[model samples]
Target: MQNVLQYLPQLLGAAFKYTIPIAVISFVIGIVIALITALIRISNKRGVMLVVKAIFRFYVWIFRTTPLLVQLFIVYFGLPYLKIAGIAPDGIKLVPFTAGILTFSLNTGAYCSETIRAAIIAIPKGQWEAASTLGMTRRQALQRIILPQALRTSVPPLANSFISLVKDTSLAASITIIELFEVSQQIAAANFQPLLMYSLVALIYAVFCTVLTFIQGYLEKITSRYTIA
Candidate 1:
């Protein structure tokens, strides 16, 4: 018990150092990518849009199907090999922190795009028609009427995604990011108390997820206030 307490501050500090930054940066960029992909997937254009949609579908498929650890390995270990093929510069290096953020963002973006797309689709056709009748352009209608409602509906799913991303950030340790879980492993290695160390790590993650859940509930209430239901 004393040993566990002794390591608590260091583990928690390392979590704040690496885990939170990776999750926040990745999730923010992921939201941007998801919004863009969702919009592109819904476009009505024929040739260009078809090609774009196909590309994004392939991207989402690849990320969703592969293990994230493999993805991280590819980014961290494989990318630098491009120099050997005369593609990238010889000096190119993929830092663990940068690679971790990039991998997590791409993975989260692929999954969240579908959630956002479905939310956008769920908005009634009547709302678009109503906006059109009011002399609104397609962009205007989407910006004013459809998107707000879609965002409201999207809150729950996106919140879940963010929570999942927080947990997934631990996987960054596989590539030497030295996050919360990695810190636990280090402590356990020295003390020979894997069970106790891991239990503390799990408890910290549960606390983070629980806080996110409360925030999710609060946001749901705020978004629901103006909703008809």
Candidate 2:
């Protein structure tokens, strides 16, 4: 009991210092990546654009299918062996934080792109036609009419993604990130009380996720206020 209390502050500190920042930054960047990917997937462009779309499609497929831990290892550990004669003789290595952020963002972005794509597709064709009749281009329609509605629909799923991302940051620990989970592991090792320490960290994660869910519900209400009824 004393050991748990003694280490509680250290765990919370790690959560604030590493876990929160990693998840928040990754999710924000992931949303940007997702939006761009979704838009590209839905575009009708050809020629060079078709090649671009193909690349993004492959990116989404590969990331979604692979395990994130393996992805992390590849980025952080394996990349260092990818030697280039001129540019990177010792391979392309990144710091632990950068690697973790990149992996998490790409992984989440791949999944979230599908969520965003479906939301955009759910908007009716009539809405696009109406925008076109109003002297709006496809870009204008997306920005002014279609995207707003799609955003409303996407909020719940995207919010869920953010919540999931918060939990997934724990995996960053395996890459040597000193996040909440890693801190707990350290404490458990010191005290030789793995179960209690693990449970405490789990509780902290639950609290973090629970708070995000409430925020998600609030955002849903905010986005739905101007309903089409």
Count of backbone clashes, every candidate in sequence: 0, 0
Off by over 4 Å in 1: 84-87
Q: For model 1, where is the 10-residue window of minimal lDDT?
A: 83-92
Clashing pairs in 2: none
Write down the worst ten-residue block by lDDT for model 2. Answer: 1-10
- Candidate 2 C-alpha lDDT tens digits along 1-229: 7758888889999999999999999999999999999999999988999999999999999999999999999999999999999999989999999999999999999999999999999999999999999999889999999989999999989988998899989999999999999999988898899989999999999999999989988988899998837
The residue pairs that clash in candidate 1, if any, are none
**Residue 3 deviation, candidate 2, in Å?**
3.1
| Best candidate according to lDDT | 2
What are the TM-scores, per candidate, against the unseen true structure? 0.95, 0.97
Whole-model lDDT, model 1: 0.91
